[model samples]
Target chain A: MKLLLRLKFLGTDFCGWQYQPNARTVQGTLTAAAREVFGTDCRITGCSRTDSGVHANDFAATLELPFADCPIPCARIPAAFAMRLPPDVSVTAASPVADDFHPRYTVLTKEYVYQILVSPVPDPFLYGRVWHYPKKLLPDAAARMNAVAAELVGRQDFASFMAAGSKITDTVRTVSDCRVQREGDLIILTIAADGFLYNMVRIIAGTLLLAGAGKLDRVGMRRIIDAKDRAAAGATAPPEGLYLNRVTYHE
Target chain B: MKLLLRLKFLGTDFCGWQYQPNARTVQGTLTAAAREVFGTDCRITGCSRTDSGVHANDFAATLELPFADCPIPCARIPAAFAMRLPPDVSVTAASPVADDFHPRYTVLTKEYVYQILVSPVPDPFLYGRVWHYPKKLLPDAAARMNAVAAELVGRQDFASFMAAGSKITDTVRTVSDCRVQREGDLIILTIAADGFLYNMVRIIAGTLLLAGAGKLDRVGMRRIIDAKDRAAAGATAPPEGLYLNRVTYHE
Candidate 1:
């Protein structure tokens, strides 16, 4: 049976989502747990390939079992997996899917959130969950960041935001929403799109950070987007502050 | 000179606030950093003693140096100490205080927050930060918890909530406020009081959790308090969900 799984993980101690021989990765951990629970090997496919230290609030994946049926009920799959999984990773939900359903190809929109801690002194509670900006942000930093983020909406070739040395030729993507907001000492940038390139969201977050620091304006953002050069954009933001928030599927 | 320091720490890896010979503790970690920054042995006093795995958002402490003067400015003390402190402990603010000022004897209120995650599935992002209740709470859990919490606001002999082995005879404390609020899947209980007994807040939180699950009501809460016996109250909640939120000193 083909099963759809919704998972969440704190990626601080993980190498990434993909399996590596010697390193500890989310895929490897889940695969081992699946092997323990099912008593056989299984194929696991993730919807997104996250970088190291990139968290996920709602990640989608598909699992193909060797048997025709699962002995455990669909609702109890998460509990069954919990016994073999570490505390840092959890399977929130699991259900049967179509035999041919693909976790990645059937997605509609993917949303990501980048968290920035704007404070002179770091917060110990948020040690590994945010990017600590030691310098004080400007008074209107969120407004400035939002102004620049609005310009990237709609379908566009986001070549400037993509990381360098990417082999993929296609850079055109549809950005449905982008927003920046502040709550207390934390500034959050949320972006949703049909798809993302290598380090695209991180680069966009870095550009927004520049805007928040009063170093970049709307005109500067537009110029960078039009240049279509990775060097024209800001530096790539750190992976710790990034989270894949949600993945929506078509009805 | 005596310096008042405001601090924050994630206590998941520490053995509480008091200094221990071999155990890793918040006070021991801060004392080492203080000695490194001040270049001599100094006396450190904390406002309250927290248990292991209890966090602090705004803890108060006082540092008394051996010398009469400090070369580094008061505003820069936090930065100076940051170099020696770990990422899980931070000194947020430092300021000059009267030589006779005491962190524990200050005449003001102390606020604490207890976080409860009400969900069937645990959240990996909130690991070691909240008490995960794996059962579904009543729909009006917050309102029900608040109704019982309001009964705790007043000067009363809270012997039922105090730990059984506490040596202190004075269990009477003035509670300024007690509130329960819900934000999404998190149910937060905030309480302010002149002082707290050993395990007072944890016991109260456990009793409130019973109320949230529809097992206890306002009448039950009143009965427990009036009993004035430690066994009359619910079990003490785990320390991970408790936080020292704030300490307000008299001007």
Candidate 2:
């Protein structure tokens, strides 16, 4: 039987979400824990590969239990598996799924939130959770970023925002929502898209920051998208401030 | 010259805010860091002692520089000292104060905030920062807690809320403000007082939680205070949920 699992992880100690041979990775840790619970024959597949230090509020995965009728109940799987997992990672929920269901290939939209802490002095409590950008965001930064973000919606080739060395050739994607807002001392940028290229969200965050910093304007943003070159876009923001917020599947 | 310093610490490590012979303590760490910045002869005194795992957002301390004329400017002290301190402990600000000013004495009021995350499952991001209470609070828990908190204000002998092993005999303290509020999934309790007995805030928090859980009532709260016995009040809450939010003094 196939099991769908929802995960939440801090990502501070792991290399990333994917499995690596030797390095400590989130998939590696979870796979190890699953092995201890259901033996070494269980097959696991993650929805996406997040960069090192990228957090996830809601991540999805699929697990293939080898036994015809596993003894562990679906409701109790998360709690039972959590005992073997480290504190940084936890399987929050689990459910049985169609035998052929795929977490990533399924059609739906994904949402991401990037956090920036605007402060003159460092905040000790939020040291690693946010990008502590000491520079003050322009008074009209949010408005300007929102204006530019609106231009990026709809179907388009997002090649400029893709990181270098990506093997995927199909760069066309659809961004359903892109907006920026300020909540107290934090600047939160949220984006929802059908699919994302490698480091697309990070590059979009960097580009929004540039507009906020007065380096990019609405026209400039449009021109960068049309350029279709990675160098045309702004730098990629750090992975620490990024979070995979939600993943929606077509019902 | 006497220097006043503002501090913020995570409090995940260290024994507490006081110096112990061989234990890892906040004062001991800060003292060692000061020695690196201002030599071994400098004297450092913290404003108050916090139990192990209690955080501080605005803790105060007094430092007596050994040299009659210290070379480091007051503005540069925070930066200089921060280099020698760990990421968890930061000297956020420093200033020259009156020669006779004291951190513990001559205080007008102090405020503390305690955080409790009311959720069945633990939040990985807030593991050590808040108390995870799995039970669902009563529908009128906030109002009930507020009622009990109101009874705690005013000048009174708070022997019922004091810890058992405290040496100080004076139990009279004045609570200026005591309130509770809920923000999202967190229930925050804020208390301001002219003075606090040993574990007073923790005990108050415990009693408030009991009231919220329907285990204690308004009459029970008054009765506990009138009893003037440490055992009359509810058990002390864990130190991790408490934070020294602010300390004030007469101008």
Candidate 3:
């Protein structure tokens, strides 16, 4: 039976979602646990290819078992996999799905959040969980960031926001929402899109950081987007601050 | 010059706040960093002795340097210490204080928050940060817990809440406030007290957990407190779920 699995992981120690021969990866770890739980080599596929040090609050994946009648119930799959999985990765939920369902090509939006700790001193509790910006942010930083972020909404060619050296030609993607807000010392950038280019969210976050620091304005951001060149955009923010917050699927 | 330092730490990898001869400890690590930064054996005293695997969001300490003519300014002390301290512990703020100021005895109240993840599956992002309660919590668990917690307010004999092997005789303490609230999948218990007995908060949290589960009620909680016996209370909750959230000192 094909099963849809919802999971979350702290990506600090992982190389990424894709499996590598030597380095540790979330896909590799989950796949091994699935094998141990099912007593067979089941094919495990993830919904997104997250970068190293990126986190996920709600990630989606699919598992295809060789046999239809497995001993463990769909509800018990998470518990079965938990016994063999590491503490850094977990299967939160599991449900049976149609054989034609694809984890990656499914219709819906993906939401990502970037966390920035705007403080002079680092916080141990948030050491690897957020990007620590030592400089004092402007009092109206969130407002300025939101102004720049609003320009990112809707379908557009996001080539400028994509990571440099990307080979993919199609950079047009539909951004449903983009917002910036501050909660105490942390500035959060939340964005949702139908599809994302490589490093798109991180680059946008970096650009927003610049906007918050009074380096760029909404017009400047629009100009960068129109430039359609990777070099025109801001630097790609670090992966540690990024979290795949949500994934929605069409019924 | 004497200094008061406010700090935070992820206590998972440490023995605790106190200095240990061989084991890794927050005090020992901070002292070593102080020696490197100040070029002297500065005495460091913490406000509380946290247990292993516990965490602190706001902790207080007093530093007494043997010599008062040190070069580093008070504002830059945190920055200087940051260079030498490990990533797991951080000195967030440092300020000049009276020579006899005590971090512990002079405190007015300390606030702690205990977190419980009410879910069937363990969350990887919250590993070692919260107590993963696998059973289903009642829909009104927070309200039930709060009802029991409200009985803990005011000065009272809290011997039942203290650790079993504690030798401290004076178990009477003033609890300024106690509350329970739920945020999404996490149930949080926030307690503020003038002083806390060893494992007092953990035991209270455990008792509230029972109350939330319908195993105990407000009357049961009061009976346990009135009994003034450690055996009468619920088991002590794990240290990982308890965080030293705020430390307030008398002006």
lDDT of 2 by residue, B27-129 (tens): 9888899889886567788889998999999999999886666678877877787678877888888888787889899678889999988865567787788
lDDT of 1 by residue, A1-251 (tens): 99999999999999989999999999999999999988999899999999999999999999999878987888988878877889889999998888888888888999999999988777888887898888877999999999999999999999999889999899999999999999999999999999999999999998898998899999999999999999999989899999999998875
The DockQ assigned to candidate 3 is: 0.74
lDDT for model 1, please.
Answer: 0.92
lDDT of 1 at B70: 78
Off-target runs (Cα >4 Å) in candidate 3 are A69-71, B67-70
| Cα lDDT for residue A102, candidate 1 | 88
Query: What root-mean-square deviation over C-alphas does model 3 reach?
Result: 1.9
How does model 1 score on DockQ?
A: 0.67
Candidate 1 wrongly placed segments (more than 4 Å)? A67-70, B67-70
Model 2 chain B is weakest, by summed lDDT over 10 consecutive residues, at: B118-127
Angstrom error at residue B119, model 3: 1.2
Interface RMSD of each: 1.3, 2.2, 1.1
Candidate 2 per-residue C-alpha lDDT over A189-230 given as tens digits, one digit per residue, 9 for 90 to 100: 999999999999999999989988888998999999999999
Q: Find the 10 residues in a row with the least total lDDT in model 2 chain A.
A: A119-128
Model 1, C-alpha of A203: deviation from truth (Å): 1.5
DockQ values for all predictions? 0.67, 0.44, 0.74
